[model samples]
Target chain A: MINEERTKMMTRLALYETKEGKKELKITRYSPGDYVMLQMLWSFVCGTLAFVIICVLAALYNIETLMTELFSMDILLFARNILVIYIIFIACYLMFCYSYYSYRYGKYKKRVNAYILRLKELYKHYVQNGNNQNM
Target chain B: MATLLMMKEKMKEIYAEYYKVIVPTVKAVVAFLMLLAINDKIGYMARLDSFLVVLVLTAVCAFTPTGITVLVGLAVILGHLSALSFEIALVALAVFMVMGLLYLRFCNKDLILLVLVPLSFYFGVPYVMPLVAGILCGPVAALTLGCGIVIHYFIDYISVNALTIQGMAAEGTVDKIRVGVDGLIRNEAMFLTLISFVAATLVVHILRRQSMDHAWSIAIFSGAMCNVILNFMGLLVFDNGPSVFGLLIGTIIAIPLAMLVGLLFMGLDYSRTEKVQFEDEDYYYYVKAVPKMNIQAPSKTVKRINTQRYHTNQK
Candidate 1:
């Protein structure tokens, strides 16, 4: 006789393991701070690269005018302005990453905790059936 | 109504029975249409303009991940733009890079919105994107749709100015790039559409989340109204937005399509709603459960009786 409850529990566990459980298992291995920091670093790199692409495109668009104004241009002021914009842009992007990854970590933690609870319940059922298993 | 529901059930049954084949077929059809639209809009490259090439690419897109289709679409667009001018292609690449790095990374699942929005605009039913996005997605969809609007305008600009850009070939590379970048930046119509669509998406998203009867229907209608009103207002003020008549016609056509999306995705039978209160160790939950509008296909029984054999046995 198959135990309907055990079968249902096993099915649920198997489904989770295949779906979100794959990511959640990996996520739970890291501390929340570490995960958020890692994501923020990624965001910073992408933001800087995108900013450079935009700046290059803008320079190319104004190539003729830039060539003429090259001698008279206040190079320091222009550099400073670009730097300020980059700083502000990357700061905003990093903050967004921080919030998003933090929220994800919290959610994944809750799911992992629930999965552990289900595993414990399954173990208790086995123990009641004279299976001396230690998790 | 019952007959329609029965048909829907039967169709759903058929879909479930042949899901694997149906999915790839639908994907192929969609990819084929999108590629054809691209070629029609900006087929500067002679090689990619052939029907056989599109069919081959569509076959490839059908079996791969959906993101592959998006990548292939981008490649086709770039190929056409490069034929016109390398600078224009570079400008497009930069814009796509910015959109991808900043906005798209956060919500990759909504990438299909990028393709659908431009395609809808080509079909003159652009208003459906925001309405459908509002019903099905969250606020992030507004940003994705905005990116789509930008792409449509970029393609439109290139198509409209292909001759002008080609005529300026002897002027210098700087002039061509400047014209391409400036056109995209100075496009008031694109900005207007972007703002209106984003607003409509947010309105629909908010309204559909309300716990009321016919909320999705109300949300879709209100979203359509918001889109129409905003576009009309922008047109009256800016005088450079989409034509008033086209805007009106598109919104009128979009309302029913949006309703169909809502019904298919979120149709609920509210008459059988159940409200229950339960308490657990940490919290008390007040839940309202509304069943989905589903009609199972009725089963048929065919019983065969051999009367001649029965008569022989009796004899």
Candidate 2:
């Protein structure tokens, strides 16, 4: 009886080991809040990059001279002003991104901590069951 | 009373999960209006009018919940009206605003790239390209004229007007020819806008699904296809004669075209590879372990044995 119980516990432990190996296959759904923050950060980066690239090309090609005839402002000044405005906009956006992510990460950590506690309880239960069988 | 309480609890859980989705959707609507206001295309009054429209629509959709079936219908009508008012800026703003708000509300930042990618295309293709052409044309024309004058002094060809070449006219035709041209321009703009909207939506939908691990491509494709169908229906009702056959054919063509555009323009499948791991120390075990067990366990067996059994025992 003792040997059978020992063998059973060993088998169960082995099963758990195999399960652990396959844990990555588990589908973890994101909380919608986290997903949105990440999306915003991505758009911010892409938008800024695009704005920067366009500004650079406009400067390099001296596209402003083409516009000076049509518009009141000098091409170089207009480009400079637009570039400055975009830079400020991008800086503000980055600030928003940092604050938002930090708050979300904090919330996520709390949820994860609770999850860990539940798992620890399950682990305790499995251990107790194994010990009872041994007795 | 007990059942009611349980139902309330269940509703709360659903709300918790859906809150992210709802917040962003509402925010997007608000932001789009704000953008319009900033752009001066829509006055405060118009923004207020649209805000009320969106609010009413939201309330109706929320109450019916099943009204999602009609979302595309509403979007089409509003989108069309907005476009007619030359409020494309407002519409674009609304799209991004809604997308941004939703991203913030839902915690889906990665999907923003989906919005940005298409936005870049929209701005790049329509506005930037035209501006570039306009800018470059003068210099090129000047160079050509200068060279011609230097080489062949007798050869004379005055450059075509930039505004005309750029397709901008101060005064349009007022007679039958005017009507025909107006009709053609309207049709062209509508078609282009439809294509652009569909393309953007498709790109976003594909990215969203791939990001969310959703298996509802059919639903999304159908929804997008429905836009063209709805546009045709609007045309029949409001504008020209009813062409049911044309509507069907347009939908058939539009669906594939939108999909093709989406596939070509849609960026990386980053969502597939990017894993969002919760780093909380306390919940780490639950997040990492319980979900594994819950998933690995025969799903049906766990649902039947654990949740149902627990409910029954409690009862």
Candidate 3:
């Protein structure tokens, strides 16, 4: 059964190789908010991972190459540099996330509110019969 | 102010009129420059490295189908590699085959650009491709962009380090292949560009969809800024990169190119936002309208100027 399911998945993947198929295969059950949320969530994870990995690599470079020649005196400085970079990365990433989320939410909220008002107006008109039809 | 606005509208009309021809021609130039850059950097055959040949082929490509251009360009590169050596040719062929497989799987209109973009970057003409991709393509195109960067950097890394490559070749086939694979993995620039393009694509994609004034311009500017800043940060962290002034100059050039991409894809006028409310038997509907901004194609209707002829015949 597992093998059969895997085969089905593989077949679907192959089928969606074409442009039309890919477009047809979109998971449109979610709202734009959910879509954006998923996008940001993945981006955040990827960006954070990238920063951590690069900083680790930088630290490794410092230890393996610069430490033997420059000695223990600069160790504190190297560590400080890594900390500063990581802080900068965090600050920038946070700012971007905050701005992007707020912008999306602001517009989404406006549309949703407008929809609610329209629905309320319709309900009011129905309660008043044809006298308030224009409402 | 009214006159200036009128002039701007007129200019937009003229721009839209020739956009079809212009797009293909620009793509052709980009393709030609990319092919030439690859040939100059990595080609083995001196005879096939002629400027006229690439120019003619690219010109023909502009008129022909996009697939034809891609095929011809690949064939030329393969031919050059074969001239260099059978082993290297085989290596390049394998690379091409894999990319071709991926292309088949994606089956996208970005087939030509999926390869050409990274090659263009390798030549220091990176401004156009990313901006164009960001302006026009979806988030999924980032995957193709990543693939392009890997192939470009891999091939470039091998071509530049002849001594290491030749030494590895002397050892054995397995060693040679290992060296190529290792170089690809170790390439930091490739990773940086991949990240930059992906981020830019996402930012532009989202921003362009917003129903707001100046969204396109904002998207273009921000996307360009993101690409420049990301690449700069990557270089600073990983390797010795271009100096600050050089970077600044490149960014300056890039913004306008990005703006051009924005203009080509998004019309000059803002798409007016509309809100409407309606009620059905079951429920009320609130709809937001966004209009597509495009120019109507020029159409012709012929009417004979026969009034004078009819008058003369009547007389």
Top candidate (TM-score): 1
**Candidate with the larger DockQ of 1 and 3:** 1
Alpha carbon lDDT of residue A30, candidate 2?
47
lDDT of 2 at B206: 43
Q: What lDDT tens digits, residue by residue, belong to model 2 across residues B60-120?
A: 5444432241332224334433433322223323333333332323332222222222232
DockQ of each: 0.32, 0.02, 0.04
Score each candidate by Cα lDDT.
Answer: 0.83, 0.38, 0.62
TM (chain A) per model:
0.89, 0.50, 0.52
- Can you tell me which runs of candidate 1 are displaced by over 4 Å? A130-135, B1-12, B267-294, B298-315
TM-score ranking from best candidate downward: 1, 3, 2
lDDT of 1 by residue, B127-230 (tens): 89999999888778899999999999999988999999888856578888887898678888998999999999999999999999989889999998999899
Candidate 3 per-residue lDDT over residues B250-269, each given as its tens digit: 66787787776556444435
- State candidate 3's TM-score: 0.53
Note the clash tally of each candidate. 0, 34, 0
Model 3 stretches with alpha carbons more than 4 Å out: A1-135, B1-28, B51-56, B163-171, B240-245, B267-315
